[model samples]
Target: MTTFGAILKAHHIDYKLTNRSSLDEWFYSILDIPIDELSIFDISRSIRQDVFLEYVLPRAEVFLYEDPLAGDYDGQLLYDISMLTEAQPPSIMAILKRISAYLSQLDKHNLDSQSIKSIEKISALVRN
Candidate 1:
């Protein structure tokens, strides 16, 4: 998991970021401070745009819901980020573009109801 993902997990937001890289330990070390005291500024300073795009964005699920194809349901990564975008480190347009590209390439028929709802939520983000 990427450090950013770990941060969300620490906050009780369960989004799985599947990038295992050399910098993982270095990033993890930054969290030695109490999780409750960690601020958005601290997170922004610790992570970069490249890391957010490459390691975090791709696997960020839109919604977490109980469905056979949906895996475990706990939280929505994109939704969580969207809710906190005012304090988010990465550019909103960058996030929107990446999500657009992902949706464009996806097979709509393969999506479950929760996934569709997830898509809807993200689409709402675009409108906003």
Candidate 2:
């Protein structure tokens, strides 16, 4: 099934960004946090960026619930991001908007327009 990993794979989005010192630094800050205590509230307390979402999706279950959807990386690709963006940190949602390019590049056949707009609106709320 097309999971987050699958979609990212389609885009050649590197899952191995830990090799970059900047990404590695921010990644570890979140990664090092105790997952058990991790909350959307706390996670966004530090830094919020589109890159971070990409960085965190593979690792979301460490803190958030495993993807509720049975398919698609169990929901890391969209659901958790949906929830976090919906929660409206404003800044977080703003950061999320940065993924627009990636989302646009995603094969249209893989995601329907309605779903795409839904996500766009999620991030756009901060700008509006």
Candidate 3:
């Protein structure tokens, strides 16, 4: 009876607090991903591997690449995704692309701030 909630916990990703009956339903609705070809598992992994690769860039790939829910997941991840797949098959590549877009934007923001800080430090040294 492995559940998606258990899987998310193993990954240190907590489900957001919601007033809805089912947190999974709430999360999926908020995400509003238009799945058409790929599955949720595929999307999650791609988000970990190719998409958010650098977002989680510092972590070991084992926790992501092989199986994010492999360790302690009950079977909920599969069940939830199965229910979702009933609606529409998602495009695996498209999901990866979408995740990549968000990750790249985040990386740019982080890098820009870091760069500015580094530059400020260097300028202060020159002044001294």
lDDT per residue for candidate 3 within 1-128, as digits (tens), equals 23334445568986675665663454444342422233445443433324332222222223323432322243222222222211222343333333233333333343444333433332332323
Q: Can you give the lDDT of residue 61 in candidate 1?
A: 27
Q: Where does model 3 exceed 4 Å of error?
A: 1-64, 68-72, 89-128
Give per-candidate clash totals. Answer: 0, 3, 11
Q: Order the candidates by lDDT, highest first.
A: 1, 2, 3
Cα misplacement distance, residue 70 of candidate 1 (Å): 7.0
Give RMSD (Å) of candidate 3 vs. truth.
17.7
* Alpha-carbon local distance difference test for all models: 0.45, 0.45, 0.35
Worst 10 residues of 1 by lDDT: 63-72
* Per-residue lDDT of model 1, residues 1-128, tens digit only: 24555656667976433456645654555534543343443333332333443333433423222221332232234334334332334554456556655554566687666656655665666655
Query: What's the lDDT of the predicted structure labeled candidate 3?
Result: 0.35
TM-score of 3: 0.20
> Against the true structure, candidate 2 has what lDDT?
0.45
As a TM-score, model 1 comes out at 0.37
In model 2, what are the clashing residue pairs, if there are any? 3-72, 3-73, 67-74
